[model samples]
Target: MDGGFVYGGSGLSTIDGKGRCTIPSDLRSTVEASSNGNVVCLARHPDLPCLMGFGTTERDALVTDLKKQWEYAQQRGENFDRQAAGGPLASSLTVIGFEASGRFVVPPMLRFFGKLEEQAFFHGNITNFYIWNPSILLAQETGFEMQKEIAEYFLAEAERKRK
Candidate 1:
């Protein structure tokens, strides 16, 4: 990639019959830089109707964070079973390697959950990217009416950061 390739941008892509989709070049570069080789990790977002991708370093950090959260809940008298809470997150996580051509396949279950068929949408979110089924993503938006909501959120976040 040319220097200064920005990380956060949105784009569209299509999945082949084999469930392979090419990672956007900039995103791919970032993933490769952080990962040991072409391997990247995939996991279900705990709450969102989307998947999360992580490089080696990112995955380690995430595991640490989850452990901390589990411990915090334990101290708060919440009956969060450590293994029970961590098992799903751990089991759902898989490491995948990009093909020589920069394509990676989403596993079958993730594909079904993502509802990704012929087309997929890629939205870069700084450290990682979100692969979304276009229809599902669009359904979450309020169309043109989202402008007010977006602006309010942007302003509120900007103000909060200023404090």
Candidate 2:
């Protein structure tokens, strides 16, 4: 979350028949460093039609932020349901382990939620990265111009490779 392990760069990967895809090299190295291993925590974006991926450190930061929010609400005499606040965050994330080669399985629910098909586009956001179904990303009408352009470029590149 600070000086180390910033998620940056973007790439595209093809989903294999078994619902597995390889994380791009630059992103994968940062994930390994931040998590101290080959595990990545994945969850559906709370507001988007994509999957969010991060390491343990980012996950810890999210938990700490939630606690701070609860305390602030308590100080204001507002009733904070900690369980309700944390339920979606806790239940949505799934821990996935990748091989050293950076290949990992995509959980079926996440895959469906993300609308992933043959290809996924990866985009970095410093603390985390988004895994997008390329067409779905391009279909987004608001914001994400840079991400959409990148996804389009990758989709073009993949098409070129096939011919």
Candidate 3:
């Protein structure tokens, strides 16, 4: 549960028909260092259109937070959102192992949920990384365009925050 894992970087990888892909070496090493043995947890991203990859430390922290929420809800006599919490934590998590060559198979269900084809785009976000279908990640129809309007809006937002 030490906080030394640095999951950052972006790259593209191939996902074969059977959902097997080779983890990028740098990312593989990072996960290997923090995970128990060679196992990494995979889940469908709750909000984003991607797969969430977690190391042991981050996964432990997530479970801790969920436990706290459960305790709070119980004390207050409030309904616990077990579906929201346990959906990803228990039901949907695809626990998989990394091979000596850093190859791993994405569970069929996860691959389908991610809409993964032949390629996946990996974007690291500190504690975890997103495994995105290249088509989905690049599709502008999803409002992910990076033209002038959105860029300027983000710039103005940053400026406003700076003050």
Instruction: Give the TM-scores of the predictions, in the order they appear.
Output: 0.72, 0.94, 0.76
What is the Cα-based TM-score of model 2? Answer: 0.94
What does the lDDT come to for candidate 1? 0.69
In candidate 2, list every pair of residues with a backbone clash: none
Highest-lDDT candidate: 2
**Model 2 lDDT per residue over 1-163, tens place:** 4537799989999998889999999899989988989999999888899999999888888888889999999899998888888787677899899999989999899999889998889989988999999888898888899989988888898899999
In Å, residue 92's CA in model 3 sits off its true spot by 1.5
Q: Candidate 3 versus the native: TM-score?
A: 0.76
Please give the lDDT score at residue 17 for candidate 2: 83
Instruction: Estimate, for each residue in 123-144, the C-alpha lDDT of model 1 and write its tens digit.
Output: 6666666777665665665442
Q: How do the residues 64-139 of candidate 3 rate in per-residue lDDT, one tens digit apiece?
A: 8788899999999998985687675466677789897778998888988888888766666678877877667666
Model 3 worst lDDT run, 10 consecutive residues: 146-155
Clashing pairs in 3: none
Off by over 4 Å in 2: none
